[model samples]
Target chain A: MNLKRLESILDDLEGFSDPNIRYEQYVTPSYVAARMLHTISLSNHIEGKMIVDLGTGPGILAIGSALLGAHYVVGVDIDSSVFQIALSNLADLDELFVGQPPIDFVESDVTKCVLKPKSFDVAIFNPPFGTKGNSGIDVSFIKAALDLTKVAVYSLHKSSTRSFIVKKGEQLGAKVEVLGQFSYDLPATYARHSKAVKAIDVDLLRFSHR
Target chain B: MKLLTHNMLTSRCLKGVTNGYPLKIVANEVKTENVDYNSEFIARVIPKVDWKVLSSTASDFGVSLPEEPPADIESNEDMLRKVHHALLEIEITQGDLICPETGRKFPIKQGIPNMLCNEDEVK
Candidate 1:
């Protein structure tokens, strides 16, 4: 819709703080977000189609999709902060379009959030890997993600827990595919005690509910 | 480092710790700069954090934080400011996060962390 408004919202969001300072939260970098969105839109022919971003922090992926001409983009996150930011971002975009198709932000957990099943053309996220007292919530998040869209793309670590999500996705009858893997650096404050936690292989997984 | 990595990392690389719950952070070089933050993002992530890991790590980074996080912190600008600064400001520009157990070194270079070890040492 309104590209300028989108830019302004992003600019404003940059000053707040690292959103992921909470828990299991990793804000997808702009490059990763842009790259993932491009891959999903191009591979799935998502232009002019409905798109959703689950766990949509700062609404980057969802906003990026809308900017790329998605018919509609919905971002859902359990955190009110995330939803608020996304709502603000979308509102700005709507202002630009002068009453275009609205971008939606729903505040709900990925597992329990109600979705318009089979209604979304594409869904994207950099999901949490229930490692840090995650309560293993990502399992339900992935299920909800796959259930809500025709095609879903996610970024995840290749930990044992994440591997289960990938395996289960295949069993769910979706045409599951692992697209790409890249290592992302953790922040400096993290204790450099592990075996390099080679775990953070940002996987671009495509799930075709077709 | 991102809390995502903090949540999953263990000090097993250095060796001899039964529970490497909180990896010790000894930052030789630290840089705190402009990292974007959105309150909404933090709120959503609160449930998924490893609080023990975070509070301990924050202290290591020279930040004194709350042991228990308050809910509805979104409207609390003061609290949010602290959260913002602790997470986004304190950057580890160059340093080693030593494993408390194994004493292995994970190098941070140019704001990026290299956790890769040689082939022989992996096991």
Candidate 2:
């Protein structure tokens, strides 16, 4: 499927009904998710690849990867309530790729899960930006992804954290690249944000294992 | 959990477990469903899999697998088909994944393995 069609389908995905500040839960915008997947697909990474989506909220990235011909997609989330929403969203687009790779959802904390080392081809996640009290969470996610991945990790983080991410990537012996930048619409789910929608800059960082 | 997932999982996180790999499978139930086979996908996944662990686990489930993956697996259609079956077709409906070192059992229900451990189990 083309980017437009995939984004249109992902536009219908449900977000958190009651988001938690502790996890800094914010649904990744469909446009950003589509763009990231499209870029990865262009690099010849999506097809026939075992993809894992950590902290997959509503399974947007997982579904998009499956639509783009990933061999298998696994969506892991700590929150159980989002599974139903993700399943429904996946069911809606199941017929689009009749014989594409199968996608499965697992409810578990990403950090604590026992996924085999170097099993997955690629790991993708739009982790919590660590803005709300939970600092350094994104680093942990990147570390875990690197531990499980054989090729590369595609992550979304605030552009401001580039230096920190670069340092972390260096320590892990992976080369980090800033693929692109996109504006994220952080919906005012919490009362602190006075505006209905707050725009923030996010960078798509690719950490390729050396 | 399929043998594919089992091949990747290890019990290294369990308390006092060293080289906690290839958790022993005690399957209470096993099921198989027809899935479309993709030779290219299977070929790509072969190199990433732990062949020894997969072979042993498949044998426990009565599924036959070659002792080692073929050197020319990319071009071997029969080998690819066998791998596709072993990895994706077979499913563990219910079971316990026992850590090789600690003997701790992680229960599986409806094909989802619960790998979470108590706070004390965390290193």
Whose DockQ is greatest here?
A: 2
Q: Give the residue spans of candidate 2 off by over 4 A.
A: A190-192
CA shift of B44, model 1, Å? 33
User: TM-score of B chain for each model?
Assistant: 0.75, 0.94
Top lDDT hit:
2
Instruction: Give the CAPRI class of candidate 2.
Output: acceptable
Per residue, candidate 2 scores C-alpha lDDT tens digits across A1-210 of: 788987888898787777777777778899999999998998887888999999997889999898888888888887766776777787677567654237766656788757877879899889987777777888889999998888999999888788988899889889999999998778785324689987888899999999
Residue-wise C-alpha lDDT for candidate 2, range B24-73, written one tens digit per residue = 88889988856567888888788888898877777776678789887888
Interface RMSD of each: 15.6, 2.6
DockQ for the candidates, in order: 0.01, 0.46
Q: Name the lDDT value of residue B31 in candidate 2.
A: 84
**For residues A41-116, could you state the per-residue lDDT of candidate 1 as single tens digits?**
5664446555667777778777777666564556766555555555565556554442333245554455642333
**Residue A59 of candidate 1: its Cα lDDT?**
80
